[model samples]
Target: MNPGVHAGTRGTPLTPTGLSRPSVRSAGLLLGLALLAAATALSLSVGTRHIPLDQVWSALVAPSGTESDGIVRELRLPRTLIGIAVGAALGLGGAVMQTLTRNPLADPGLLGVNAGASAAVVTAIGVLGITSFTGYLWFALAGAALAATAVHALGGARSATPVRLALAGTAVNAALFGYVNGLQLGNLNTLDEMRHWSVGTLARRDPALLLTVAPLLVAGALLALALARPLGALALGEDQARALGTDLRRTRVLAVLALTLLCGGATAVCGPIGFVGLMIPHAARAFCGPDPRWLFPFCALYAPVLLLVSDVIGRIVVPPSEIEVGTVTAFLGGLLFVHLVRRRKVARL
Candidate 1:
């Protein structure tokens, strides 16, 4: 089914809309891909030195007399690719979490997954002297898992509720942030070393980090995709879902774990990126129609495109010293969040 003409609520068609479903979805996907391609070109062509678009394209595809090709292929390609991956993870995870928890505001970072990962990395660095990004990937994953567990524990029971889940998430976020700060305090060296990593930056990432982290993030996203039907069933309320053979507990566990892998690995590699999760889902909804399957994949693509473009913009706007990617994303994500809260359009999700 082309999805551009009809709306599917939980693996079932809910209604037929005015527009052609296939055409609408196709247009959205086409637009996303076009933007991504343009963003990739812009990222390659617009750097410190004014490399002509033709030269950049030629160099990127096949090396030439000068080092331009090598620079484009070697340095910028990896960074741009990693941005796409990380952005996808954040966006996909955000879409999944929002659907899973049935709350428009839910995001991996907002619900403290990134904070948990950050805290874990801090613990590792402070106590174990673990500085290698590859080595600490597990630390981040474990921290995210623990933090996720804490949130669920506080909100998972029948006595517990989704609103409580969010509150628990917020409390955990604050407490973990404070603890990380406390550990950083009274030790200038620790603070100095962790400052860049803690501030949600893509400062200096290992090319290998993407390779190491991609599998986990991709797997988590796949699992989240699998939960789409059950999640939509649960969305009508747990009782309705149970009547529909949806296992609410299992779905929640799986979704949270997916979030752990995506947010944790991304945070470990490039610090805690925020708003990609919170904002991308809303964007995804405009096309995907609240179905996680469509929303999930689209978010993955759009997230990276948005983030990389933001990073590229940062590079171009400020001469030699580039603005951090997280800084640019946060400013935009924060603004959207405020509007989302007030507009009632975004809040319905």
Candidate 2:
């Protein structure tokens, strides 16, 4: 049986079997929100020096000139906020990619978006002598936009087939990675700065840094949310969507623009964190079926859960010297991906 085919031909919304119950969806959303809150609290409290919940509350409510105040206000607070934003961006980006390509395994990292941004940053550092991340941010966004345009062009945007897009992304990703590696190898200065930024982490981020990329991330997120219905309409196939008056060209352009902003902004702030996007969207599908509208909300809530939990785990797993959040998420997400594959739960729309 063709997994993509179904009995309905009216372009009506389709939910995965046994998962369309409204009560179930409501419960799932509530549970996801609760878990997100818990994770946010955990992120604020648990670290190298674990702060008690009461102290955490006090630090949040009113700083009292204590050591906990400094740690809470200065360090963990910004890191937690950034983690939430980055995680949400990755999750939404992943959802968008999977929906756009109708591919179960699509992600920004795998699609060369992250590599393109990273390469641009490296180039800025090496050739342009851009010393600060603020300078790197503009270059990263441009690189991501260019890479996305290239991918669509190579993939035959007029047709916009899944296999062609994936192949083009793979080829572009490899080429960009080669350039990044070449730059790193040739310049010791580039290597030193690039190595640290390349390992995705939420540490040492200032509240001011969050302000830098917030507008882009917010814009991308709002665009994604607004396009939820059109994305769902896409599941009915291109011909059906066109018959229903969906503009395929406009949709593709908008989706690409939204993805560039989200992926580019996140990478600019926290490096190229992988798997969050790939893992969360599939999980969202399992919870709320394949409706992009439903899936995105869950993705927004649960992705931060995964990211914050992974960061907390990273803090304690190795004690004094903490492992990066990216490493922890990669380890966990890889295991989840393997498990999902084993169970045959991952499928294209």
Candidate 3:
């Protein structure tokens, strides 16, 4: 039986023989919740003003007339929620892309999505004079579609094996970023649009901002859920998946669409926050084994947790003057990424 076909007495994929494996998912859920709670507390308590943890909880649960409550509820909460949304999307997106492309190293950063979104947004800012993020989603989605198409053209139908996929994505990423850098250098309006956005912030102007992006995120997520079984089929190799009645073209299109929905909208909202997608899935697959059915939902929970923690770290680590999430995530993710590289181990996505 295929690895996608999990431990089932009746030979179905992903369903174990009854509820015997409860402890595995239970442990994962507990760990994810613990991370989320810790990150939330840290977010509430460790800002420049340094409210106590209890006060942080109070400010959250009991938003009364207190000054600290106002500070915590109004200023900090929205940012935290945005981080959750962005982080979860990236995490899940990265995992699915890797699975679909069969590349453990593939990420929006490694791939063309981030660069495409950046280029599209820059174009909107520089040539079109559109400065609002709400107005930028269409461009971001267009860029991501173009980048993915370029990857398909460059990689060809047979070249989506892990090594080749990453190589193609890297080449595309470098070229696109190069173009974006030139635009930023030559155009003041582009520079203005990207300068703050490039830094990556959770502190959005409105909680309503999240509502705007939520549909894309939710759509991406549901599509990923639908694609998981087919992806598992593909993970066995294209020839095998085809033998199993999985349509490779359909799977690829769905994966690309899901990625565009998730990453494009995310970049439109929060700039190119890198590696949440790359690293979170790597971590998830490390624990959950080879099934995307396992990896997908796990990422849904864990990615937001990672982002919220990272965002919280940025808030408190520097006191009054906080670091941007992109820089913080880059530095931290860079170190972990390097460690993974040094190990030279690719966990099967």
In order, what lDDT does every prediction score?
A: 0.78, 0.85, 0.78
lDDT of 2 by residue, 58-150 (tens): 998988989998898889989999999989998998998898878878897656789889889999999999877677778888888889888
lDDT string for model 3 (1-349, tens) is: 5544366445423534333244456677788878877887777676778899888888778768799998888888887778778887888888888898787767766558888888888888888988876777678778877886676567664445545656777888899989999989998778987786677777664677678879988999899889999999998998999999998877876787788788877876788887788878867765577798888888878888777777777877878777888888878887877777667654345
Clashes of each: 5, 0, 0
TM-score of each: 0.88, 0.91, 0.85
Clash count for candidate 1 is: 5
* Clash pairs for candidate 1: 4-20, 4-21, 4-22, 5-21, 5-22
Cα deviation of 317, candidate 3, in Å: 2.5
* Lowest lDDT 10-residue stretch of candidate 3: 12-21
Q: What is the alpha-carbon lDDT for the whole of candidate 1?
A: 0.78
In the range 1-349, model 1's lDDT, one tens digit per residue, is 6654455544444335644554567778999999998888877777676667898878866677688877677778778778877888888888877887788878887568887887888888887887777767788888888998888888854444567778889999999999889988956666777777766655467788888888987888788778777877877888898899877777777777788877777787788877889888887777767876677878888888878878887787889888888888988778866776677553564
